[model samples]
Target: MSVAVYIAVMAGVTYLIRVIPFAMVRKKIKSEFIKSLLYYMPYAILSAMTFPAIFYSTGNTVTAGVGTVTAIVLAYFDLPLIAVAISAAAAAFGVGFLV
Candidate 1:
């Protein structure tokens, strides 16, 4: 297929996937469980996408693991996001240098 045609088809498919859900769901969702699930879906999806990437982001799995643990610990303590990120990166870099 031509590149232009392929791009157009893909765009249409993507648009339809997003649009059809809105078009079909005309009524306000009433169930508390369903509403809660929808509210948290984005966070769940983000974590699902991000958690795996964290393991492979550093050059070595060991370094990545250290970074992830550091981040988790800092986050658990309610540290600022910047602090968590910096500490994690520093830990990963330090571990990388050692290993």
Candidate 2:
């Protein structure tokens, strides 16, 4: 496919992936279990994205990884997102440069 067509198709698929879930469940979600599940969905997604970086190293959890530990601890305070990103990036780069 051409570059434009490839981008368009990927965008359409991405939108559909997001929309289809809610559209399919809107009417069927009438139970407390589902409601509670949906309520925590955003937090769960955030945790899923954030928590892994802290614990999982190349293939294992490295508690001594100061960069990962620092990032995770700061994340609990609700500081600005950019600060967290920069700190994590700096931690990684600083350690790599020194080693």
Candidate 3:
């Protein structure tokens, strides 16, 4: 398929996957357990999707680890998102160059 068609199809699929659940569940969910589960679902899914990429995005796992640690430290300190990202990339690059 052409790039535009592929992107359109993927966007439709992603949109449907996210929207269908809300369309089906018109009533407010009453179960606290289920409500809590739904509240945390996005964070859980995001972490699942992102954590593995962080470990493999750099050329080496060691550098990736350094980057991940740097990001976590910066985030813990409530740094801005851009600062966290730039510092993480710099840490990874610096470590990669030195090693």
Candidate topping lDDT: 1
lDDT of 2: 0.72
Select the stronger candidate by TM-score from 2 and 3: 3
**Model 1 spans with C-alpha error above 4 angstroms:** 1-28
Cα misplacement distance, residue 39 of candidate 2 (Å): 2.2
Candidate closer to the true structure by lDDT (higher is better), 1 or 3? 1
lDDT by residue (tens digit), candidate 2, 1-99: 599999999999999989998787555667999899989999999888866555555333433275676677778887788897678667766666555
Evaluate residue 21 in candidate 1 and report its C-alpha lDDT on the 0 to 100 scale: 78
Pitting candidate 1 against candidate 2, the one with the higher lDDT is 1
The lDDT of model 3 is 0.93
lDDT values for all models: 0.93, 0.72, 0.93
Weakest 10 consecutive residues, lDDT, candidate 3?
21-30
The TM-score between candidate 1 and the true structure equals 0.67
